[model samples]
Target: MDQLLSTDMDLSSAETDQRIHDLSGQKQSGLAWVKANVKEINDWVDRDGFALLRGLNIVSTNQFSTILETIFGEQLSQYIYRSSPRTALRNNIYTTTEYHADQVILQHNENAYSNCWPMRMGFFCVVPAKTGGDTPLADSREVYKQLPEALRNRFEERGIMYVRNYGDIDLPWQEVFQTQSRDDVEAYCWKNDIQCEWFNDGRLQTRQFRPAVMTHPQTGEKVWFNQAHLFHCSAVDTEMPDSIGADYLPRNAYYGDGGEIAKQDIDVINQVYRDLTFSYPWQRNDILLLDNMLYTHGRQAYTGTRKVLVGMAKAAR
Candidate 1:
């Protein structure tokens, strides 16, 4: 941590609204500091699951993008096939999640249900809530080792199948795909090996199979890398409305061979995530970088306003 803060930069949290496009001049200090410790940050995140770099003077979403792009040495990845509602604040930055303060987002690896996902993700806290809003983290490696051998064997063999229903209850197809045209959505599905079914009633469904565990490209370690619990019907079965059919529940997971994953299995996954999770309260201008596969994250229900910007980086297939 001292190596990261070796350079002399403004340690105070100066919240400014002006967007920073150029990293030269006054912005160069932060960029240079990040450049100096780039390897350390990556090394730490690879050794552990994540690294929290506190005390940075980030002004706007553009500045957050600039610092993260510097560390990544490339442009940030767009949040495609998004499952949650997030308003884009800049070209590559968006609000973490627009869910109400009382809604607790379930723990899951970012985009783990999809074939392609960002290897790294950064979260910048612009505003901290008055009460409780913490991004809890869990080590997926431990999750993998602690799960039952029989259950792991089943998932390793069958993989995981994710089915998403779009229209009501869940996100609409247009929002999920970031397009209004059906043709565009179909083309994307075909390219990504996702099976899409369009109903005459204006609803859309997609099914894709992805592995439940993956070996980290950098660490050569296996991690429990799927979102079965978050996507299962058991996650929201109690709050579901009577009018909506159970089959139409927003998203669900099953065995790769088209068999249902029992609710008990989902319960077990959730319990393990809860037991392994750890969190810290947000301080404004704090930046968090996480290895998306090695760690899983979730939001806790809060009281007042909370604002956090997210950038996904280092795309991996």
Candidate 2:
């Protein structure tokens, strides 16, 4: 098998002259070499489904976002506090079951339900999970080609229905997050363009509606997607939820009866993950840039103290 491409080649490009003016790496006076070779640096990312950008200490969110936009385009999602070092460290004390690609199932693409397109995503590992917490990734494009005709037709026509009961899972991380104030939560919702209602009890709630399948804006490849299974909050009753207890929220999915996929289908999908997945055991400095549409990722349970910082950016089309 051909070795997966690595970031060692002399990646110069025609656009390097123009790129110097657009990137901050040149203005700041450090990393001038990277700025001079900007096209090559960016091409490495464009050519690969993902890239492990080693040694660059991405401590500044603004600088990180700039680097991402330079390569991925301008429509990146602004950095938000997905979690803090102090908080993420506390949350990792409790491990959750592994699921591929974001907080949901092993589905392909991001924001499948919405017309809002995502070009790609960046995951910064600030705090790694304890033992056994490796991240597994797979090439969805390969999976798409290898999918059996029968399953392909069924999904092409019907898509997928994802359902989960997040509250029942009793993840401790949820408890730590409950400490957020109404305004803090509302700001978060607003930033993500989530429609939400604020309760008298100081809780903000909302339901997100998005497509279960998505077409890559450029490639036009079809992807199965839905946050219902991953982000458990996808279907929760945002209103009156803080009163009843956070876990009371029910995460569910509805699909055509009889024709809907079942556990058997999930098994097959997971099998694909197992076959195509590449894993990176967390190192404190590891930074992962993922082709959100082309690859899927997951996390596993672990035991030890892992500290990873994450910065998420959407790729540009």
Cα-based lDDT for every prediction: 0.80, 0.46
Best candidate (score: TM-score): 1
Q: Residues 1-317, candidate 2: write the lDDT tens digits.
A: 00111111122232432211223323443233345556776565567666665445455445554555555545455322221112322211212222321222233344443334355665555567655555566666776666666765666665434322223333322342354465665565566555556446433335444444456555677654443333333324345346555434433333423243444554565555556665665555445666677676655545655444333345332
140 Cα displacement, candidate 1 (Å): 0.5
- Give a tens-digit lDDT track for model 1, residues 1-317: 00000111122232331111122334445556677778877776766667777665666788789889988879998888998898887768989978777778877889999989998999999999998778887789999998889888899899999999997676888988999999999999999999999888888999999999899998898999998887877776565635577667788889999999998887777777777876767888878888899888888888988998899989998
Which regions in candidate 1 have their CA more than 4 angstroms from the true location?
A: 1-29, 239-242
- List candidate 2 segments past 4 Å from native: 1-34, 57-66, 73-108, 127-130, 160-213, 220-249, 256-260, 314-317
What TM-score does prediction 1 earn? 0.88
Q: Judged by lDDT, which candidate is best?
A: 1
